[model samples]
Target: MESEQAERFTATLEDKLQSLLTKASTLQPEEMLIRHNGLLYPALLCPEDNLRQFAKFDARPEDMCIASYPKCGFNWVNQLFRDIAAAVRKDDGQRKIILLEFSGADTHQVINSYPSPRVYGTHCHYENLPASVIEKKTKVLVVFRNPKDNAVSYYHFCQKHPLLPNSASWDEFFKEYMAGEVAWGSYFDSALIWEKHIDDEHVMIITYEELKENLIGGVQKIAEFYGFSLSVEQIENIARKGTFQAMSDNSQETHSIFGNFFFRKGVVGDWRNLFTEEQSREMDAKFEECLAGTKLGAKLKYDLYCKT
Candidate 1:
C-alpha cells in the first residue's frame, strides 16, 4: 500500500512538472503566469491545479485554515497551531494537516479524505478561497509581516533554495518584489484581500510583530479564537514551544518538507541591515502609494513595530 502511494505521488509530481514546464515555455520574458487547465497562476513551486481544486473544496464548519503570504512567519505560527491542537484536541486522535500548495498529490483528494476538524494551510490569496470556507464559518487565521521584511526574507529564500529561480542580488530581487513580480504575486494584494474579511466572525488576522512582542498573549488570542481555554501554564508552554529557537532546533525534521533550510533569523527589522537608506525611502514611497489610506495599511504599524 505504501509503495503504491509513493508511486502515485511520484507519477503525479512528474505529470504536474511536465505540464508546468510546457506552459512556462510559451511565456515571454515579462510574462510570469503558468497556464494550467485554462487558468493562469503565479509561477510558484506548486502545481496550479492544487489551488484550483482547493477553491472547489467543500469545507466543513470545524475546518481550520492558516492563510498567509509566503515567508511571513507561517512555519512559526503553524507550530503554535500544532501545540494548540495537541492541547485542546488531544482525544481527537492524530491530526491531519495539509499545506495546500506544497504537495504533489491531488490536494482536493487529500483534504477530502481527512477526517473531521480538518486543518489546512494555504498561501492562496483571499480572493482565491472557496466561498464555503467563509459561508460555512470555518475558522481562518491570516498572518502577515511588513513588506520590507517579507521581501528581505523571500530574497534570501529564493537565493538559498534550489527550487526557486536564482536571484542575482538583493537590489534585483527588491525591484521584482516591489513591482509585485515575485511568485505567489503581490504581498500587498494578498493582505488587502484578507483584511477586507477580517471582521468576519470566522476570520482572525495576526502579525509576526505582534506574536514576537507577546507570544503568550498571541497564543492566548488564538486559543480564544478557537474557543479553547488554556491555563496560564499551558499558554506559557505553547509560547515557549513555539519560539523561533524551538522551531530552529527541530528545523531539520520540521523543514524536511521544503527540502532545505527553511528557518532563518527570526528577528524583526533585519531588513535594516539589507536596505540602503535610499532603498528604504523607495520602499516607503511604494508602500505609501500602494497601501496608504487603506484600513489594512493603517494597521500595519510598519515603522513602529519593525524598528522597535
Candidate 2:
C-alpha cells in the first residue's frame, strides 16, 4: 500500500486517472470543465490539482523552461530544443520536454530528481506559473503564434484530446475561444501577462513566424540563450532534423500515442482558410488591445502575420 503511494503521480495521475475514465463515461462535456482560480480545465487531466501540486516543485537556477500558450508551436519548438540539446549533451535526447501543469505532481517529482540543466515546460498563463519560477530566476523561453492560427489549431486539437470538450465546429469553437471559455483560458489574457516579462534577463520570447522565417537562426538563438555555444555545423544539422517535414515523418515514433495529430499543416496563415473577415478583425483588435506597444508585440510582427 505504501509502495503504491510512492509512485510519482500518486494523486493526479494514478488517482485521478481512474476518475477520468469513470467521468469520461458518465459526465457531459460541460460537466467535465473544471474551474479553478478563474481558469477552466478538463477534469480528466485535473489540471487544477496538478497545478497546485506543481507549485511545490523545487525549481533550480539551471532549469530551462518552455512557457507558452497552447497550440503556439510548442511541439515544434520542443523538437528544436531537443535536437540542439542532444547535439550538445549527447544524452538519450529524452531529458528535455515534459508537460508542466498537465502532467501530475509525480512527474514533477521525477523532474526534481533529474540532474542539472533540465528542460521543463508549462502552457499556463504567466501569472499562474509556480512562483518559484520567478524567485529562482529559471531561464524561460516564451513562444507565441498569431492568435488566429493558434485558435484554429487548438480547435482541431480539442476534437482529439479525450480530456477536452470537442467543439462541433470551428464557428462554435471560435466563439468559446474569444470568450476565453476553453481550457487554459484566454490567449489575450496570457499574452498580456507575458508581455511584461519579454525583456527579463532570464526570459527569451520568440514567435512561430520568426522561427519559421529563420529556422537556423532561431535554433542558434535559442541554443545560445540556454547557455549552449554550438558550432554552425551543429546548428545546421539540428535545423535539418528539426524541420517540420522531418519531425512530422518521425512523429509516430516520438509521439506514438497521438501520432501525427500534433502535426497538421505546420504553416502560418492557415487561419486564412478558416477565419472570416469578422473573425480576423476581432483577433486583430484583441492583439492590438492586449499586446500592442509591448516588446513581444513587436517580436510577433503583427503586421506581417496577423495584420488586418
Candidate 3:
C-alpha cells in the first residue's frame, strides 16, 4: 500500500511539472533581457537564441558601470545614481539613464544614440566583460546582497517572470539554484568573482545591507568616488527621492519601467516569510561550503534570518 502511494505521488508531481512547462511555453516573449553567468543572453523565445555580445567598451572618463547579482538592489542603486547625477546637473526632467545589457535587444545602440556621461547597468561577471571596460579605467560600482535574500528574491522574480521556468515549490527552485542550473548560475560564485577586483581603483564594492543601513552616507560615498561634488541641499534631495517607500510609490519608476515590474519589493528579510527552517539551514550550509575561502564570505556576512 505504501509503495502504491509513493508511486502515485511521483506521478502527480510529474503531471504538475508538465503543466507548469506548458504554461511557460505559451508565455509571449517579454522585452526584458535574459542573463546567463552574468552576461545577458538573448530572449529564450527569440527566433534564434543568439546571445548578444558586448561591443568593445569605449569607456570615456565619465562612463560608470553598476554591477550586481540579480535582485540584489541593482535597480535601487541605478535609480539612486540617476537621481544623484540629476541633482549634480540640476536637471529635473525625465533623464535617460542608458542601461547597457550584454544580451537582449541592442541597448548599446540606444546608449550610442545618447550623449556623454552615461550610467550603465550590467550583471556580466568580471571575467566575461569587455576588455576595454577594465583597460580604459571606467568606474565600476558593484552591489551585492546576502545570498539567502538573493535566492528568495530570485525565486519570487522567476515566479512573476514569464521568461523563466517557474518552480512548483521553493524546495524545487532551491535545488536548481544550488546546483547553478538556473539562470546566471550561483549567486555566491558570481559575487566572489567580482570580489577579487573589488579593491581596484576603478571598482568599488557596496553591500546592499550597508546601503540600506545608511542611504545618505552611501550615496555621498558613491558621489565622492565618482569625483562628483554635491551641495548639502542636493544630497538631501537625492536621498529623499531614492528611499524605498518613495520609489515603490512611484509606479512610473521601476527596473522595467516600460516592461515588467522589476522593483517588486525593496525590503530585506523577505526570505524568512518564504523559507522553511530546514530549507534555510540547507541554504546556510551551502553558502558556508561553497563560499568558505572566498573574499565575499568576509565581505557579505550572511544572516539567513537577518537577525544581525
- Best candidate, lDDT: 2
Q: What C-alpha RMSD separates each model from the true structure?
A: 4.5, 3.9, 12.5
Candidate 3 has its poorest 10 consecutive residues by lDDT at 44-53
98-193, model 1: which lDDT tens digit per residue? 676555446566557655556678777777677888778889888888888898998988777544664678999888787676777778778777
Q: Estimate, for each residue in 93-113, the C-alpha lDDT of model 3 and write its tens digit.
A: 245454454333444544554
Sorted by TM-score, highest first, which candidate order results? Answer: 2, 1, 3
- The candidate that wins on TM-score is 2
Clashing pairs in 2: 8-106, 9-106
lDDT scores of the candidates, listed in order: 0.73, 0.80, 0.68
The per-residue C-alpha lDDT of model 1 at residue 301 equals 88
Q: Higher-lDDT candidate among 1 and 3?
A: 1
Q: 264, model 1: CA deviation in Å?
A: 0.8
- For TM-score, candidate 1 versus 2, the one ahead is 2
Query: What value of lDDT does candidate 2 attain over all alpha carbons?
Result: 0.80
Candidate 1 clashes between residue pairs 3 or more apart in a chain or in different chains: none
- Candidate 1, residue 244: lDDT: 87
